[model samples]
Target: MAHASSTHDPNVYFVPHSSKWPFFGSIALFVMMIGVASWLNEASWGKPVFFVGVALTLAVLFMWFGDVIRESVRGNYNRQVDVSFRMGMVWFIFSEVMFFAAFFGALFYARQFALPWLAGEGDGAATHSLLWQGFSSGWPNNGPAAVGGAFQTIPAWGLPLLNTLILLTSGSTVTAAHHALKAGHRKQLLLWLGITVLLGCVFLFFQAEEYIHAYRELNLTLGSGIYGSTFFMLTGFHGLHVTLGTIMLAIIWLRCLKGHFDRDNHFAFEAVAWYWHFVDVVWLALFLFVYVL
Candidate 1:
């Protein structure tokens, strides 16, 4: 769509005409998913296909978001459109909540029910003798058979604590940035937002270091059984979110530099801030349950 179809009639509810990005984006994602599945199954051509799909999807997203940025900047978006975007983001975040909930639920089930049942604690009197003879129910056990030998859990008070603090600081910085935007303090907005992005980057860096420590020094990995799997899955997905949020913050920072928002009509900034806060909250839950617990 080149421009909004509705001229000046606010009642018209402007809509883009026959957008192709959605179709292309869907195809790109399908390809990416196929590649990932193939790679996981150890296909010979899987790595190249996965990389190609990743590149294609990223390109589609870049172009698609660029179009969206252009459309928003062209004043094509009305207040109604802004409302739609807000509603969409709300549901999007809700879906993300469900996604993380499933993982956390799995962790809870493993620790509370599955482990105990297998270890003959509750109702399985003869199961432990039939299965793992001397298996003891524990929080961070590597299943009954001890898959991938023994592994050490990361210390909660070390990098995890530091990362928690970094994310908490980032949460405050992003909020301050949001307030700066609403108060029309562009300079302050940029400053706080920049710091938030920096903090996010630092968090990811520390997480990488933590992962390395887990793998090389502690003998922990995704194959170290249930504990290893959950640890990486929870922290890995959270890190991916932080990376995406950081990128969005950087883009929003640029938009701020270019004066893309006003005191009242800055739903874009608000949306990212909302997402960042959601990430912050998720990290807090992860740190508590996945680490300290």
Candidate 2:
């Protein structure tokens, strides 16, 4: 064999073997899904199974993430690894966009086609008149008057507007943190990250309060009507994404505290930033479709 190079190559991305992480992750997800489905059906042991699955999944995630962190700290990942991670994140965000698009498509279809037809428009005008006689056309609001449960529409004022501002500010804060990182201002980066996380928490708290206000005061609930269902499915999922993005940002901040990244090689932080911005965009869509319209 030819003589090997004496010096180690800094540009190579070296990753050790991880034997069972993928298998364990699959099992964890399987258990979780079984538990969720069973629990939804009121099975007796579903909750326990579900909680166990959750615990298992969390443990696996911690261990897996720990390994990655160790590898990162060891400087084993090169720019190639970072590029792969960037591509993965891009695809993941794209999938999420498509998911939200499906829901939005449903909303659009209902509004443009189904609702109009039900209101005696086009060919449906004659059929609607005979089938649902004396039924006046109006947007369904679940309350004393509507067909669904006793509920009402959530107004687009006050807390919602405040939440909009909060999320907008959060987006800015995250961007600022990214800029600080690029500038190699470590202290400023950490501070901005912390502020971004705080804003995320504040947004979550306010959203919880808003949900309570909607349920107790406005009588808006998931089971109210098509409107309520779509509203919850959109905003609720967006909120969940926000929570996840916040956790990711918090983790990145913790990594930064440990001096994990630099100006030229900070892909982890960039990935989280992309996710946060994705959450922001989804929320803007929700605000327009669910609140403004």
Candidate 3:
């Protein structure tokens, strides 16, 4: 199983195509949006139709990815394809950074500008002091700006700490797996890769449990106020990224089992590993700022 490398292989090159993937993707997105609109409007069948579109979109994604993987395994991917993949990953990660940045910006504005102004911290003191008397800037307030609810903040001691450790450990294991693959230690690579994947899954399980506890036990939700909003936005996106990274690792594991990648040329495996590690880093930042601070 020869992995794709930088070397140009003319036999494995594909001509540019006018493809239907764009149309299929657009249709799926449109249907999903319609479903969202319908659901919001209380349409009886909106949810079902939206779910159908979701299924269709997923199928399209599966077919698209399957084609790419098949082409790679069949040696139809040349250096050009590899470069395209690298560039695509770079841009994909950039877009994700921007997405997270928006949420962070919201958090910043809420903490600095909105919260303070509401607390009479600035020149708007006259306006703020008149409207929301006795209100102070803080993270979690279950009450209104005047008499906010007294909800307890989630502690960063137990579950979040454990999860942080789990993600860091998984990152290390993934690094070890990459090293093993490069060294031609197939057995070692499999063992470490399997462990890393299991860690990712376990992290997800614990995160879901945490969310359940927050909602049911502590009454913490997206509507809980600024605290809930920022908490959910940051952690929710991080969780989604973790889920995607886990899926990527699972695919890499399957390919490994099938002996699809050689030690000398496993760019796909490396790329996914890079992405997984990047996700881990982002989670670390989230854990520190969102949970601890």
Question: Which candidate leads in lDDT?
Answer: 1
Cα error, candidate 3, residue 170 (Å): 0.8
Per-residue alpha-carbon lDDT of candidate 3 for residues 1-293, written as tens digits (9 for 90 to 100): 23564555655656535668778988998898899679857899899989988888877877777776776777766666667778988898888888888988888788778887778887868867678788778765433352324455678988999999999999999999999998988999999999999999999999999999988878787767788878888998799789888988888898888888887767788888878888888888787778877
**Residue pairs in candidate 3 whose N, alpha carbon or C atoms collide under 3 angstroms:** 142-149, 143-148, 143-149, 144-148
Q: Using lDDT as the measure, what is the rank order of every candidate, best first?
A: 1, 3, 2
- Per-model lDDT: 0.88, 0.79, 0.81
Estimate the lDDT of model 3.
Answer: 0.81
Q: What is the lDDT of residue 290 in candidate 1?
A: 91
Residue 219 accuracy (lDDT) in model 1:
90
Q: List candidate 3 stretches off by more than 4 Å.
A: 5-13, 33-50, 142-149
Q: How high is each candidate's TM-score? A: 0.94, 0.87, 0.89
Report the Cα lDDT for candidate 1. 0.88
Task: Report per-prediction Cα RMSD to one decimal.
Answer: 2.4, 4.5, 2.9
Q: Which candidate, 1 or 3, has the higher lDDT? A: 1
